[model samples]
Target: MQARSVAGEAARNLVTGTTRALWWALAFVVLVGGLAVADARVLVRVWQDADAFRSAGAAVQTLASEREQVVDGTRCQALSGVAGLTGAGALRPGAPVRAASMPSSDLTVWEVTPGVLDLLTTTARPVRTATGTTTGGLWLADDLAAALGASAGDELVIDDGRVRVAGVYTWPDDGRDRVLAYAAVVAVPATGTFERCWAGAWPVDDDAAGLLYSATSPGADDLRLGQLNSTRGSGYDLSGLVDARPTAVAPAAAAAVGLVLGYLAVRTRRLELASALHARVPKPFLTWQHLLEAGCWLAAALSVTAAATGVAALVGSPGPYLGTWATAGMAAGTGAAATLIGTLVGVLTTREKHLFRYFKER
Candidate 1:
């Protein structure tokens, strides 16, 4: 009860106490809270990018006779087994056909199997402005359409036949499309009878990552995932964003600050503690008083961080704030607690057997 009373009194002293070592410990608590909040904010943005990239980064694979690559039905079946592939398809490629609108325009045509462009080109967020229908015609890229001096209604006369231009889809020509912007998809036969199978998946796909990291024993076939388009992704690091693993940095730094303050709070005041002990004051009371002093300031710092969190949420930050608080706060809290513990431990463990040591040191 004496320790409790002393602690209670010291807790009151914190507000009126001079701003010094204990205040610095409180500052560290504030630092911990701020770090947690910052980490939460950054993680939120990264997750948004991750969700978008999960689809936009994937480009279908290719298997074409033009490359002298032959793929059979049995091999195509393997694509079906891939759990990561959200969409898979087989499209035939025709020889380069000359567009009637622009005689010099050598356009590639794909014999699309009606409706699946989104699934095939998973890794892109281009403004896919599609217009009209091919009615078994071609789907021209908006950019390609401009180049050919053609529109949705106009027919594209090729060597195979006069195909009616259906709709057009405009997406970026980044490595994710795996198709050419200057290409058209028509619903007719191409020169090639065999079709190339493509999968809508990227390396970040959890299905792919799961399979790769499975604890299952060896002898599993390695699924080779590749993209057809060979260009950089749409200005984002699709798979290499660093997470908050280094969040400990802030707390570790706070701990160093706490340690210095703890030294000041305890070592500089040993004589006072000795005088109290001589006056028949219990060592535990002195220890608790110092701890309470530390706690009051640290708790105040935590309060400031909490206030900041409220401000962030009010300003429309989608939170993981609680998570950051727990992570960073716990780390910083331990260090701050250790400061008090270390200070008190010093008092209890000192070799001073009498009040004479205090008087002599003074």
Candidate 2:
């Protein structure tokens, strides 16, 4: 009966000691937990954006490759009186037409008809000159503009004539490092038959392909034409920007901070642990006490992290929240690992005999 009373008292004392120790470090725990939650949110958003960007880039690449194959394989001549070709509406009697060709020197020059600019409303807008005049000749992509050392209102020599640099524009696939430029087709010499055409009312019907093939060259089996629809693919890749290095840094730092704090907490209770050990408490019981204490601290930290995450989601934005079970699982796992590691280190370093010797010396 006496032994049972001592065991009960020891267990109660263990709980009280754990509570006192945790109270001293509650502020630290809250601070670390809050930081962890913030990092998790940022990480989740960045990862999602990165994945979306990568998928878009892949789609763009596939489309570009297919377009290249079509352009390389076909020799096409203009077939008059052909209607319903994809983007053929832009060629209405008075409507402007845009023709693109690569004559030489890896340069693609586009000649846009007068009203063609309006049709490109979704593309980057042409910038006006400082003098308030609209640039009237050509719009270059930023990379192309930089390559020529030209800006808005500047003049660039194309086919022996100077064309005004209207402004810079970017395509969605430009994120994949493509070079793009545009100009009034008249500025470029009437080259070999135009290779590609862009119109406002691009066709999406099943018969559109047949219409295009029949329009290019009827009765000529040697010539093949292919259509490239740029509107169907993704536009960007952010994988490089959101790499593993940047994503891992925050969680790693949090784990290290948590481990250090847990270690300190454990060290502070070494004397209590040694006393319990000297009182003939089984090693398993003592180990269980340490683990239980670590678990309590970890649980408290996780609770604070969850609460902070919920509050931020409610007070901040109206979009779908990104936090998931995986995120929570990661945070919990890291916190628990740090706590258990600290507990093991503390127990191993401070022996029961060392505590008794220190007490005798005191």
TM of each candidate vs. truth: 0.55, 0.44
Superposed on all Cα atoms, the candidates' RMSDs to the truth, in angstroms, are 8.3, 13.0
Instruction: Give a tens-digit lDDT track for model 1, residues 1-362.
Output: 56559856676656666325355555564555566566545555554555555544433444333343233323343354576655544466656788667777578776644324544334333234335432366777667877876676677777667966665565564545446456776654222323454555544353443332121123423333345553534233433553344543655665665666565666666776677777777777777777767666666665676666445433443335555345445545655665666666656754346567767877
Lowest-sum lDDT 10-residue window in model 2: 86-95
Give candidate 2 regions above 4 Å deviation. Answer: 1-18, 21-28, 44-236, 244-247, 310-329, 356-362
Question: Which regions of candidate 1 fall more than 4 Å away from where they truly are?
Answer: 2-4, 18-22, 29-90, 93-122, 128-178, 182-194, 200-225, 229-263, 303-340, 343-362
Query: lDDT (0-100) at residue 284 of candidate 2?
Result: 64
In candidate 1, position 109 carries an lDDT of 74
Worst 10 residues of 1 by lDDT: 209-218
Clashes per candidate, residues 3 or more apart or on different chains? 7, 2
In candidate 1, list every pair of residues with a backbone clash: 55-122, 56-123, 56-124, 57-123, 133-166, 134-137, 134-166
State the RMSD for candidate 1: 8.3
TM-score (C-alpha) between model 2 and the true structure: 0.44
Error of 1 at 323 (Å): 7.1
